[model samples]
Target: MPAGPPGKHNAQAGGLGSVPALGRPERRAESLAVAGLQPFSSVDFPGRLAAVVFLQGCPWRCGYCHNPGLQSRGPGAGPRWPELRDWLARRVGRLDGVVFSGGEPSLDPALPDVLDELRAMGYALGLHTAGLAPRRLAVLLPRLDWVGLDIKAAPTDAALHDRITGRRGSVRAVRESLALLRSGSVDFECRSTVHPAWFTDADVLRLVSELSSVPRHVLQLARLPDASGTARAPIAWPSAALLAEARVIRPDLQLRAA
Candidate 1:
């Protein structure tokens, strides 16, 4: 029951269902390449207890990437599905659900297969994504128990967003995903990390207000220079003054240290 790097627990070594393969199982998804795994987490999925599965590969090259190491598709390619399923099999009784997070979980063409395998085992499925592809999101929506959607920038700020993401039109995909989630039956929320240098007080407030129609809209105060993920150089963020302004306009916000 100890929580540490994966070696501590093998939830699926010999259990109810056999471990699944981490390859191209889902015909609709991109592929199944795993980067890392966390056996247990209380914070990742709100109230539910669950395990965190980190998927590898991402198309976006965000400068502040926390997991820059996992961005490459070719590096971690191998038979990953079995490892994931075996690990989860070991955890069947203890954990309530699974959280698929990543360099963008939807990028994997084989994700639907992985999800189906998890569902077959009676484990609830959750996902954390940047909302890169609305079409793919539509595919995963029905199977999702909950989703933590990260909105990086506003739709209007294309140039700034493109600069931060090193990709054009990504903002549109993110926005479309947001709208899709809002209308869906799934329990979901939109969370934006307020990295001060990225946007001004006015920008953040406007963005928050725009998402007000969503049942759950959270404004996260971003922390900088944290090398744990793919974060690179430090950037200047807004002070308490801007944060306070956001608190007033945004109804529900999750503030983190910046």
Candidate 2:
């Protein structure tokens, strides 16, 4: 999508840039609130065996969020950062990288320092974020090896985008973040979680048309939550016609099943 000039929404209240950076004294490894950790994952970081650190807390509330438990900022019964780091330390040469997946990794103030520490230990770092923190992301970009940016909707569809995220003015922040990634040297991919319940065929086409210029844009089917709240494969898929049209708009568009 065309990267529009920043306007009032870009400066909206509660943007991550408003959060103060952690002072040196408070930049401890444990300062990162850990919701959970995946010891090893081949898929989390493309082309690498890596551990996924699931950080706690997120600003948005997407209905299709798989990590809903991570939405809260309050302390949970998850591993401590020091403990997780010690485990990663032992896998120094065994793993190719470390991925910071999260309710929103950029929301944590300690992230910049944490990235520095992991980078020094010789692990390429990756981040999974929804672009809720454009200013924070700008600071973290120089330290990242790869980033998976989650796009909820076309940048021009602010109402639809905010509705999906259950947050106001999210499109503005995501737009700025997308612009940052486009202008930077970092390798990144744009991904959107799609479900017929949430996105109609026209919605999918609009999103893909806007992302036509992105090097990699993935359309991942959104998993449904069973009665027990476990994520299961989607019962339905986007129409074949829609997928065909999407590819015509962005030939490089990738469709992934849940």
Candidate 3:
């Protein structure tokens, strides 16, 4: 499009200049600091060690959103990545890996630089995305070691799912991403959050059946929390009737109810 405030290259007149077209990197060997880092995590991705990165900003306004503070993109906060990079620089031998999570880390224009930096740091990479921008997955999937994709709902009807996400195009994006990643190189899993209002037994079965052929899909029964958002109350789990339906439908289904 126009220009990138003269960081490295100048866009040619009337050309798509310097944006690097989704997956390509125009420059590396320079600034590649990750925005945020959580020293260690147990629940981020199954068994591997990871650091939670809080990349700022997101496009959707799902009511079930847990990190509301990360929704808004604020003014420059003095490059958290540089310091993160320095921190990682010392832990090259100590930790397992890094996870680039966010308000939607993929949406951040600087993700490539940060990911580029992480790669240089010699740590394995993992990601958690809501599948907002499916096309970008083609680019980002190659960079990650594992992916935990939050699948909102069935692609058959957008309105039902959109009511929760508050975004019309999210279902389409999520579906497209699932289809595209069915045969990709990265190790990935698809999970749907089950809350009282958003899902019914039939709905869960439909969701699982639709994704029956996907390589590594997982169904995560999201534990609904109390008003404080910190303390969780143990409500009755998903119905055994629904569980039976899923078992009957997808023999290879991977489900965990919490």
Candidate 4:
């Protein structure tokens, strides 16, 4: 089911509530504050037909973010998962997988159980994340079938990374998550959203060079900010020439238009 906005549900838990202890009272599934759902998607899960579940909350504030409404853990206008579940129940035969997307799916404590529920329902699990929560992701790794990881910038460039995420230590967390993915059995791809204002053509080349060992990498054009404002001058997007140069280093790189 698709979403409108969050209602009265409390979706964010303050702590990384430890994966529930065995003897504790059976917790009914925590309410997942789903920001939105794309009932069918082929692009999200690679080869499988999948549904996309956009969970709420992201610690980062990348300027080109299209889903700014999902940045806060506060009440949103998104759909509640219980209702989503009933709809999903009827879609079992039509969909082959489910992708947990963000506002950084790793930020929500309820995710592991959510994964378990979907797995039991015979759906393959996929996740899309910015890799801000390495510990959380490490715990969920074994249950996931595929992952789409967003690498914001080169791991060594902390300054640029922080500027993009508007948070400290985010790059370190991303690097650690990358390490975990490389060591695990899960199939995955790394992608980046590029803006000319934040990165030059040389920078893209350098970033791709660092990611040369990754099995797959994609370069996406960042969405330009709203054009209604008069105070800000519009920034030009990275050109096709830039993507061409990047493909030279990572020959298999994919380019996505804004």
Candidate 5:
């Protein structure tokens, strides 16, 4: 469940369709449009062995998005929610958790209900998001067990962030989400996917400094194109000096392969 593109998804925009109001359990469970499901994942939900649900539709269009197929709001080609639910029902105690990933899981109004269902079924819940919809996240906070929030760029560098996300006002939403997470009881972490072409050493340091209050911040190196021969640009890995300086700014910073 890697961070996907960010953009608003709604019925009018050809997204999954009209979002049902919160607390409407009758419709919420059926509203989800799942793009795919990873039956088992050890890395997605931190300590828990979990299943990752890839929801459809994201409003942003980051150039580095690997799941381009998921950026649209239309009906997906994967199993329907009911089918996935039935599948998960079978996993019960075998899986420790269920991670709602994206195409920005927060965009779907039904997410909270879906989380409710999963939690009731005895599975812990986790979310992966870019914080594009802070209000939605606020509603979801109480339902989540852990969250992996993506920090696209330094808070002050909105322009750079907009360029990466292909959308304006993203930084403001991310800031709001960060604030909410800071004040809440839920366990969470901030992560950044760094592509050397898009960020400099100074930028990384600044981003880390902005997240000083956060207990954990992870820096993930952008992935290289797969063997399918997709024409992705070559990646220049981060410099050791840059990583060292970032650690100085945020002593708890962790590095990982994307």
Candidate 6:
């Protein structure tokens, strides 16, 4: 996502920390720039039958980010929110929940209203986020039923974390968001995607150590989708050694790689 217009903190805010949504007004539902939609997904929201709404616009430029096309703001490739609402209405008993994935869903100010509508329809709400905006997450926390937070790096390792995210100071905001999740009643899971090219075994160990207090943690090996081109050499999954090591740090740690 481009830098926030002046007065709203951008990369320069306090020099290299995740920028917060400061002084921004609430966005309207019509303002939702949806990038894509998966009308049904059994995996996105855990055990529930659900749909995935991919929102547009993300400030970070993580190299391993799969949805690079969703990085920009404005009208996305999917139907607008009004159309989505109509679709959701048709899904009443067929779906148990809706998961909002991103381009950092928290960046959309109209999310609170979106949550209200989902609640009225009696659908559980789940959010997948990098937690770019702590203030926004703090407000949305109460409305969330499940959250999947991407822990890109250890919070204190600002330089490396920023390097991984291609956005300076993002760790600060993630840490704040994690703290809010911990202090709230919401059920959340923290996960990090690892590619040997960017992360070492020691890095994973350090991350797990830092996340020891979280109730659930997942470690997923990055995989290029089928459309990404089969000509490239097959990538190795995260080593079982690494998973074993992570489990040592947190016995309950879950491995999301296959």
Tell me model 5's lDDT, rounded to 2 decimals. Answer: 0.79
Error of 6 at 8 (Å): 34
Across 60-91, the per-residue lDDT of candidate 2 in tens digits comes to 99987877777888653455555556656667
Can you tell me which runs of candidate 1 are displaced by over 4 Å? 1-31, 75-79, 226-238
Backbone clashes in candidate 3 total: 0
Q: What is the lDDT of residue 129 in candidate 1?
A: 88
Best prediction by lDDT: 5
Tens digit per residue, CA lDDT, model 1, 1-258: 111222222332223234554343343323477666666788778778998777777888876565666677752432256656766766788999998877788877778888988998889898988898889999998888899887777667777678778998779898889888878888887767666567777788777767767767666554445547644333444556765776677646665431
Q: Name the lDDT value of residue 127 in candidate 3.
A: 78
TM-score of decoy 6: 0.84
- With a 3 Å backbone cut-off (N, CA, C), the pairs that clash in candidate 5 are 6-59, 6-60, 7-59, 7-60
lDDT of each: 0.70, 0.78, 0.63, 0.75, 0.79, 0.75
lDDT of 6 by residue, 63-149 (tens): 767677778887766666765776676678999998888788988887888888778889999999998899999888888899989
Ranking by lDDT: 5, 2, 6, 4, 1, 3
State how far residue 223 of model 6 sits from its true place (Å): 2.5
lDDT, candidate 4, at 24: 23
Report lDDT (Cα) of residue 112, candidate 1.
80
Residue 54 lDDT (model 4): 80
Q: Which clashing pairs does model 4 show?
A: 5-77, 5-78, 6-76, 6-77, 6-78
Q: Which ten-residue region of model 5 has the weakest summed lDDT?
A: 8-17
Clashing pairs in 6: 1-58, 16-169, 17-169, 18-169, 18-170
Per-residue lDDT for 1-258 in model 4, tens only? Answer: 112232222243112133332232114444665776676778878899998888888879987676667888853345555556655666788999999886878877778887887787798999999888899999899889999999888878888889988888779999999999998899999988777778877778888999899879887776564566422322554556776787778889887752
